[model samples]
Target: MRSYLSVWRLPSAPVLLVAGFAGRLPSAMVPLALLLMVQQRTGSYAVAGLAAATYGLAMAGMAPVLGRLADRRTPRPVLLAQAAGYPLLLALLVAAVLGGAPTAVVLAASAAAGAATPLVSGVVRALWSRVDPEVRGTAFALDATATELVFVAGPTLVAALTVLAGPAWALGVSGVLAVAGALGVATSAAMRRWVPVPDGPRTSPFATVLTPGLPRVLLSGAALMLGFGALEVAVPAFAEAAGAPGASGLLLALWALGSVAGGLWFGARVVSVSLPRQYRWLLLGVTIGLAPLTAASSPWVLGALLFLGGTAIAPTLTVQNSLVGSIAPAHATTEAFTWLSTMATGASAVGAALGGALIEGPAGVTGSLLLAVAGAAVAVLVTLVPGRRPTRGRAPEPVAA
Candidate 1:
């Protein structure tokens, strides 16, 4: 609670939150806006889906590598470089689309956007972790809640903008927002001044992951996100297949809104429970929360069920992030945080593709949503059961890459 409290009380919190808002808004636009763009442009969902997949894979694959690079050196330079690079790539994407470019061209443009995405979430998490030990878990909760806030506000804006001016306006608006967010982040006193420990040479993010406690945290996060990410894609396609073509956006919105409410509710509190126990319970709750989604038959009913099922999101994410900071070596904290970020992104991409493929022939969205539940359940089972022996030690540091 103190960490959460101290964060806003910090002199820099105001400016940093603004930058966070700017950086996060694009996530919504990319999934929904790009889907609309590619679907409309090539007159095929398959091409659009592939294009989006390329973007996901590119971002997930490269982000950890970029974060590892940032950790050894100053984060400011990385932030500034991305500020310059991302906008230009986005501009190229807009141009390619308006010019009626081929699928490869559009796909390439999306990949460039992915490659250029700044590690805003990772940066923010690292900063929050350094704030105060008493408040670290709450801080993580606040951070996770903030992410949900982005989806809430960002998608609502995209929906309104896309409806009024089409996906082009949404894309253009996101590019401008990204620039504003990047500049805000790059120039922040905390960001400019923040540096990894080591005061020494840099190490690989993979090496950071190899650290005992970190690998476990990263693995847990990956397991949770894999399900959530896949559900995002499966929801829209499932809605269309379920005889409710117009319900996709609303259903997705309900899911995000549920997370928004749950995240805020969870973050605003302070608890003394051990981090591992917190994580275990959160995963168990997710397993229970999501169990009913497989049986939903209507969009309205599904929306209500999703809202209830979202209760696990904030708790699970907050605990995962808190553990990352709690267990990280001082010198490699930022890199360690970035690895967790990368895990979620990777899981999401894998989930989306897996969910999409599962829903293809006879499985449908019902089965796809069932897969989501199963993924979360698997995470819960892995943590509590033996034989998956954790490699961490009481006082061991992460293996240096």
Candidate 2:
């Protein structure tokens, strides 16, 4: 408690935490809201799914570019511009979908809306680099936990709003929240005081991706999320196979609940292990924990294993975030974080696709679970591979946290 309080007491911490949460609500809301809205209008799940995928791919593909812009120009103008643009784009999407626009126009609108999504997640994470070193781990843990909660809350809110009014209302509220939250983060004191690192040869667009010890970290993150993507599919399938399909949501929520508990516990304690070692051990823990799921015969058994395995999720992410802050070049901190987001998003999509195929094949649920375990094991292996040592004369300065 005191450890987390210490983080909250830092200057601008409250505003950053609050606004960051609000700004990111759209991330959780938009996919489902868009899916429901488009499905409601078009009466075609395939079209809805394609629109959602286009939106997500656009968001992931553009994040690194926006992050680079923020690194070069500071986050204030970038976030401010996004604040105005994202909602307008989303509004256009809603209008097009509701007004019986052509399929091509709707797809284009979805892509534009996603491309304009606020860069709040990466920017807030980079801002955490500014925190005092002593409690930075706890701050990252809290941020991870808050993010977990957002997914849980965002979906629930969308469901309620969709029932109360309609999918359009739910999406409209998402736009409103995005505008308000982005504006709040953009105008905050921390953002106002942040200075862009001066441009140099080391600060070039691709330089951050080439930083020492970063590629392995990014690979490890992508692998971890790949496992997560498989688990997301397998769990629901597990519940359906057990004759209680509705239990899937509850089971998954319990999994997230366990992660929240683990993150808080991990954050509050003092750790002596190096971040690299911690990352490896956490990956191993996830693999070990996930391996038992293949034996789960009922939703109760599967849910228990899920909750236990989930204890490693947020803690792993906390360590991963700390490693990025400690390993990324100071000149491109925001871009480094954005790359992490990009890798995770892209990898998770692949994992989901693979998991769906595995479930439909002879592999079935067991195969999907094995794929999840294999993904985590791959992350562990990536961590064991030696990373490039920093070159002489142009060594990057780690972000101060």
lDDT to native, each model: 0.74, 0.86
User: Which run of 10 residues does model 2 get worst, by summed lDDT?
Assistant: 392-401
Model 2: per-residue Cα lDDT over 67-98, one tens digit each: 98998888888888988888889999999999
Question: What TM-score does candidate 1 get on C-alpha atoms?
Answer: 0.89
Tens digit of per-residue lDDT, candidate 1, span 1-401: 45455657766676677787788788667766877877777788888878777776777777777776776685677778888888788888877877899878988998998888877777777777666465555666767877877877877887788789988788888877877877777787776556555533326425567765666667767888888877887778767877887887788767777776777777777777888788889898988888888878777788898888886787788888887877766656667777777778778788877897888858877677877888888788767654333342232222200
In order of appearance, the predictions have TM-scores of 0.89, 0.95
lDDT of 1: 0.74
Misplaced by over 4 Å in model 2 are: 202-204, 390-401
Position 146, candidate 1: lDDT: 76
Cα displacement (angstroms), candidate 2, residue 178, comes to: 1.8
Clashes of 2: 1
